[model samples]
Target: MKSALGKKKPLELEDNVCRRTNVFKLRGNVPNYLEESGSTAAFQPDGWGYKSHWGMAVNVYSTSITQETMSRHDIIAWVNDILALNYTKVEQLCSGAAYCQFMDMLFPGCISLKKVKFQAKLEHEYIHNFKLLQASFKRMNVDKVIPVEKLVKGRFQDNLDFIQWFKKFFDANYDGKEYDPVEARQGQDALPPPDPGEQIFNLPKKSHHANSPTAGAAKSSPASKPGSTPSRPSSAKKAAPSSSASKSDKDLETQVIQLSEQVHSLKLALEGVEKERDFYFGKLREIELLCQEHGGENNDLVNRLMEVLYASEEHVSSSLIKSMNSPSSRRSTDSPSVSDNFRFV
Candidate 1:
């Protein structure tokens, strides 16, 4: 059994890895096998043909295999390879723990122990695996160093487009059984028809005299009937006086109410006007008192000035008259007659 299994080709393991990578791609998630670049190769015991710890062993043979030596280019190449794999096959190969472990190994310190513990709380933690992987990448600032868009090159965009298309297609095609018009009509038709005799019994019957001309004439001329005419008019005439009286009383009440309201409004307005007039009248009286006091003072000053002027004029007139009468007598006064005589006649 050991000899037969030992003869198994290395191509078989490569094929398995390829198939696994394809499965991971379908799930829109990163595969673990890509991170196996630095992992140790399977070491078989002497008696056993197959290696017990095949996943743990790192291959030292490959030149670009070491995790420490692996650069951004190497990581990008791994991502591209994963993206290129068949999506359905990759889904079959991927596991949450394996993917987590791969990311933890690839980025070294990016995924913390706390994050791993948080995963236990989730229902279907694998669904969140991509987000965790992106978080890990972001933590290391891997997007800045080697942009994810350049590496993936529209893979995420393509997936999103596919999802949108699928959703639209599903909604457009969806038809509920309850809402089908044909089914509803069929259900209505399936109900049994009602009995004609029962329908006739349910209908209202016409009276024998319904179509009679006399019955129609009687109904049409009800007001023209001898007994009905006098009673109707008498009752109507009696009701009219009472109705007219009631209407007249209502109108008078309404008019009285309106007049009262108008009177009340006018009284209020008049009171306001009177208050304003009183206020202004008080102010006018105060102004009149002030004018009277100032007028008295002015009159006293004018009278005093007039007395002084009159006294001065009288004293000057008296002195002039006295001088004229006394000096040179009539001779000095007659000397002024020369100037008077020289005046043009």
Candidate 2:
């Protein structure tokens, strides 16, 4: 464990700010520029990328959220769909692999994904992944403190709060690039399984087959015994993924992302249209109310405006003309400028 820890350059692990201006930039909110030249790459408040991370990534309603609603399920679904992680809850993301990958997605070729574990079985493994995440955060100037202890505990509320902020930051920084979680992790999702199931396939299939007997055991119900590894050859049970299947899955995931983006755009457009519709409806309603309250004094103008408002789209001008010439139409000398109705607006 000491040797493993030694391999990674230990973090400064303390804050001692003696800047030229004597200003201390707060955590995850300040620019920790190593080079005085001011060239930075992480989620800094001044950064064009992940600038929102310093502030409230908690309020995920902004942007597309990239979803129809930024509800808990929607947030989790977005994560699972994007990362191919079967995350039923936010606590599953406590390992911080997903966030590291997110940073990698935002700034390509940063985090060493090979060192990062997708299936962190042990607490130490989770810590290792989070350390990598912290390194990336530090490198990129992402101004947020990762509450490792709380997160590693896999508490729902803690993880949910962090992930909600993460989702917002991701949406803010993501530039519509297709990120393959499977490919990113070298086709090893290390999908967070239940405690018992976690032992079955924590490592790569080949490694598990050789190191553990769970694969060759071939027993359908292996939860009864995690240590029992039968010597039976289990080549059929754990075949390497075919290139074709992998490609198809990638294509499908790509399509899903594209469709989701399109759907988000459509939703935004629909909202704009609805707002405009309501605005016009409200204006017309207001005008109608005015006409109802004072039509006796301004019969001709009200009649004309009413005819136009009630006109059918199939033949707008014809409908207005018909209403104007109709025998039942009211006649009055008072003709106010059409602008009166819209002048207040």
The number of clashing residue pairs in each candidate reads: 15, 5
TM-scores for every predicted model: 0.20, 0.39
- Give per-residue CA lDDT, model 1, range 38-117, as digits (tens): 32433222211221132221111122222233333443344224223222221121222223334444334555433432
lDDT of each: 0.35, 0.59
TM-score of 1: 0.20
* Tens digit of per-residue lDDT, candidate 2, span 225-327: 6776655455444454344445655775686678678767766776675466456655756785686467668678887876565443345667657977998
Question: C-alpha displacement of 236 in model 1, angstroms?
Answer: 2.6
Best by lDDT: 2
Clashing pairs in 2: 28-143, 28-144, 29-143, 42-140, 213-229
Instruction: Please state every model's RMSD to the true fold in angstroms.
Output: 47.0, 26.6
Error at 313, model 2, angstroms: 71
